[model samples]
Target: MHPSLTIRRENGDMVKDMPRVKLALVIDDSRVVRKVARRILEDLDFEVAEAGDGAEGLAWCRTEMPDAVLLDWNMPVMDGLEFLQRLRQEPGGDAPRVVFCSVENDLDRVRSALDAGADEYIMKPFDGDIVASKLTLAGVL
Candidate 1:
């Protein structure tokens, strides 16, 4: 089952009624992957949005600043690495915590993503727990 949207402060106090919902953007070419990510983020109390590829993802960021981004490593238009490079240069883009979800688990690719500005990286076949944990680490959950 999924969790509720109730928010608790760092001090361990529960926030009052109608806590502000966090926004999360899922950028992946696979529809299934995007759906999975969206479900997880929504369960974590986030208002989720999605993009089919890096280009659309980049465009999405132009309007709203999501609290977090679930990015894929490979896509049709602009790949995750390229998007990461370009995103970091955009205004307010640095604020959103980016979590790269890709099959590229190799050390060099992982290093490159981190070096390019991805805050976190997750290999393929991830569960809700893994996603939530990464968000927690990113201070998004």
Candidate 2:
């Protein structure tokens, strides 16, 4: 049985009870980045969604808001900062914890993202441990 599932007996048969699955969105222009983040989030028991840019991400959120977001700082169509701003304006948008994942490590840039309503920041080339730690701190784990 998966860690997220509970095994039980029902009428002499085994049943797997699944707990409420958390949803996570990975918004980045890079397909590789999205795939990597999705793997980590899935391993953490979250159902993951992907969007190529901030515009697409926001559109997805409007339809089905996620519990957490892994956003890229830079992308065409709309940047992470703009998406964060717009997302906050949407109903139930404030509920998702947003984490900016990017290659930018400048202090000022980090501050700007935090000010724009990002819950945390993760430098790119991130591994599972780094992502897990950041998500845990952001109260998503």
Candidate 3:
């Protein structure tokens, strides 16, 4: 299931009329990860959207034009690298800042994500405060 659907069902009221809160899209395969991310962003007053994989994530990006994107590196469909490439190619694509959230800790992978246009990177098992700090540094928070 898409994380957005779950979030909409669970926190529908909080999702409404939040214009001051910037829009963000969280793309990951794990529901637990999405829940944690949602909790953190909502606490910070971000209007959050979510997707289960990179393909869905890319689609959402095109349609919603979110202010920022939290993307997982590994997914069953259209992994993060491809999605990032496609996103950068879209018209007015440079508006949304992207941050990679993944378990892959390899320095090379981190470099690749940055080269692919990720403004920042966060490893898995992340603390909410740490993620928030990174987002702030990336100018998303």
Candidate 4:
């Protein structure tokens, strides 16, 4: 589910007057990569979800409805490009801005990702500033 920022009362009801947190998903095979991305997004004030692969990420997208996604290019089960293709076809999928984050710096690959519906692209070895910048450009931050 999309992560919540609501305050709960003593009886477990939501406390009024607080704004909901925006959700972001980090999809990559590497645990280290996911962890790094999660930390960056969280620092940007986003509630982050992580997936080990494209397939799992897509499954989460079909349900949770996050505000943004940081997707990797190479992964098991489903690659990032294939996942992007499938995600665009799913209901409400187009609503979340997708940022393709990978080591693949080839222009053609980047173009393909944009053509397939990615809102932005980030080269790997990205820092928190880069993540925040891309998310901002994509209107996710």
Candidate 5:
């Protein structure tokens, strides 16, 4: 279940309120994959955005950063690793939790992504449960 926060009103009255829906950026070249990820993220109460490639995703982040990024490893313009590296260099980029969602299962690649500031990793063909678990592990859920 999603967690709520207790906030104080202007009059000093305390109330329990649902947290703001987190924004999640889904970056992938495949329309089908993007659609599937959008559905899953929405089900988890995240406001979803889509990008066709890493370059597009980075452009979006530059404008308004999302709370979490569901990133794909391979694409036409820029790959996920390059995007991740460039993102971490941007102002406020470190604030978002990055989860690598990809089909690349190479040990070195995983290590490289984690080394490059990815908070978590999820293999491709992910289900809701897997996505949820990965997000939770990344401290975004």
Candidate 6:
């Protein structure tokens, strides 16, 4: 396991058991976008992780098993559509619900993402409130 990664089990017997933080993995090529998304999720009390591309995101998901994923449509080394398709094929209840975040607002793109198994979609330049509302709609908040 990577030294930077930590996974804590929720012990039922513990008196002060902290509610498992709703882990959210933000996958985007742009650092700024990832930072913004992380800030929004953090504001909602979620633990956030970031990946620079879809490949790294997939690797993280395999180990971290976050509760939700915020995926960017355009990225190097596996785009969001490909990631979503591959993720749906993985076996386990740990599969995180995914929301595609992108500047692509065309109907075809939206339809494609939905067809590829994304739970929701959000356009770029989004506000924290918008992200929260989308998460709420997706039942992740």
Q: Model 5: how far is 135 from its true place, Å? A: 0.2
Model 3: CA > 4 A from native: 1-9, 12-18
Q: Pick the candidate with the highest TM-score.
A: 3
Which candidate leads in lDDT?
A: 5
Between candidates 3 and 6, name the one with more favorable TM-score: 3
Over 1-141, each residue of candidate 5 has an lDDT whose tens digit, in order, gives 225644333356765655666778899999999999989998998877789999999998987788899999999999999999999999998999999999999989899999999999988889999999999999999
TM-score of each: 0.85, 0.86, 0.87, 0.87, 0.85, 0.85
Residue 68, candidate 3: alpha-carbon lDDT: 82
What value of lDDT does candidate 2 attain over all alpha carbons? 0.87
Candidate order by decreasing lDDT: 5, 2, 4, 1, 3, 6
lDDT tens readout by residue for model 6, 6-82: 53322323222335667888999999999888788888987778889888988887776777899999999999888
CA displacement after TM-score superposition, residue 83 of candidate 4 (Å): 0.9
Model 2 residue 77 CA deviation (Å) reads: 0.4
Residue range with the least summed lDDT across 10 consecutive positions in model 6: 9-18
Q: Output the worst ten-in-a-row residue range by lDDT, candidate 4.
A: 1-10
Whole-structure CA lDDT of model 4: 0.86
TM-score of 1: 0.85
Backbone clashes in model 3, listed as residue pairs: none
**Candidate 3 structure lDDT:** 0.82
Error of 6 at 76 (Å): 0.5
Query: Can you write out model 3's per-residue Cα lDDT over 20-135, one digit (the tens) per residue?
Result: 44777889999999989988887887768889998898888766677788889889978988888899998867788898999999999999999989999998879888888889
- CA shift of 50, model 6, Å: 0.4
Task: Rank candidates by TM-score, best first.
Answer: 3, 4, 2, 5, 6, 1
In angstroms, how far off is 22's CA in candidate 4?
Answer: 0.7
The TM-score of predicted model 6 comes to 0.85
